[model samples]
Target: MLQKADQVPAVVAEFIGLELDDAAMARVIEYCSRDYMSSHPHQFDDHVLRQKRESVWQLPPDGTASKAIRFSAKLSLSPALRARLDEVWADTVQKRLGFESYAAFRRSLPNSLGVTRVD
Candidate 1:
């Protein structure tokens, strides 16, 4: 599974007006936050796994130690959903990833989006 921090840095960088780079990418992998205690309303007594910090849905298909894409069959995000994505997911990603600025990281996304922002 890909780190949520990995997904977040780029999005947050876009928020605060910054650009993503290799160094930022490295940081996302390096300084990801341990957990989201604040977001969870229910408490659990069971042991929490904090290895690479990924959702169960993101786990590798064959249980191998590799990143694999997870698919959502009913994926349909509206504008409000996208906005919420920016607020909830992106904010956490930027913070946990330890980037100096979220905006910069976001600026790097368009290049990968086939928009040709990089020149």
Candidate 2:
């Protein structure tokens, strides 16, 4: 969540000695949101639903609120979406890091995938 990122930015700023303003906050949140959504569909939808159902809420840890009240957004894909995403992740790893093994691919997945990470 962006709230968790507030401390991250401050720490990063301290280390790098750079200040992050509202625009930087939004940019980082946006990037993280996309990655988070792509990685966790169940959690993303549940989070949006809970936010919509809340009549009032305490501010998130970072104190910056989401502009969108509800995340009714949907990512429509053909039935091959899962296979495609996996293939892409594998190819990306191969190209980027020279990983070329079934074990390496399996290791990259979340534990929910229930596959052994063996090389």
Candidate 3:
């Protein structure tokens, strides 16, 4: 990628949010692409996972540490479910396999929809 960085450096630099040269961009891509952790949608980062989990469900107690242990709490199965809900389920299952719990999954979801239930 470095050898051909001129082709997509801007997009990569923007996404990674670092002013990178071709060599740096190439290195970043290689680092992110080779690992299953980096390959995950949330990139398997703890802060993001915690935030997402909270968004999907209830917040952690006020005193909980930033690295609060993740746990899935029951959510009322709201009838106002969104389309392609199984995709959400699939994402959760995949996330739990190596990333986070159900609550964390909901928390990771975008916007207030994270707190909403599909099933």
Candidate 4:
């Protein structure tokens, strides 16, 4: 996937008008790998067994190279984890904007929480 990203980085950057620095991009990729990929990684094997509970797949569009790998990325998080994600998102925005208060922050931008106050 990073290799695919390499093919279109400049074109993407041009459209977004945001300079894509290597370090920043790599950090974002690394963070995603830690959170998502670390839990469920692509697994492929031959002579498959019936007990491992792994998904077997054969993808199309294999004109040149063999797409011989696939996996079931099944993940479920509790409600507490979802709320934690909201907190993390708010923290990231607050740090980036240096907002005085959460209510002021919402007023300064678009409000999606639908709450009159954020205190």
Instruction: Evaluate model 1: give its lDDT.
Output: 0.50
Candidate 1 Cα outliers beyond 4 Å, as residue runs: 1-3, 33-119
How many clashes (backbone N, Cα, C below 3 Å) per candidate?
13, 1, 10, 0
| Model 2 quality (TM-score) | 0.30
Candidate 4 lDDT over residue span 43-107, tens digit each: 32222342222334433322232123234465888999978866886788667877645667767
**Whole-model lDDT, model 4:** 0.50
> What TM-score would every model get versus the actual structure?
0.24, 0.30, 0.24, 0.24
TM-score of 1: 0.24
List ranges where model 4 is wrong by over 4 Å. Answer: 1-69, 94-119
- Worst 10-residue lDDT window for candidate 1 reads 38-47
lDDT of each: 0.50, 0.57, 0.51, 0.50
Q: Which residue pairs clash in candidate 3?
A: 52-107, 52-108, 53-104, 53-107, 53-108, 54-107, 55-107, 56-106, 56-107, 56-114
Tens digits of per-residue lDDT for model 3 on 27-97?
66565442433355344445665677787788873323332224436675545463345467658775566
Worst 10 residues of 2 by lDDT: 61-70
Best by TM-score: 2
The true-versus-predicted C-alpha distance at residue 21 of model 1, in Å, is 1.3
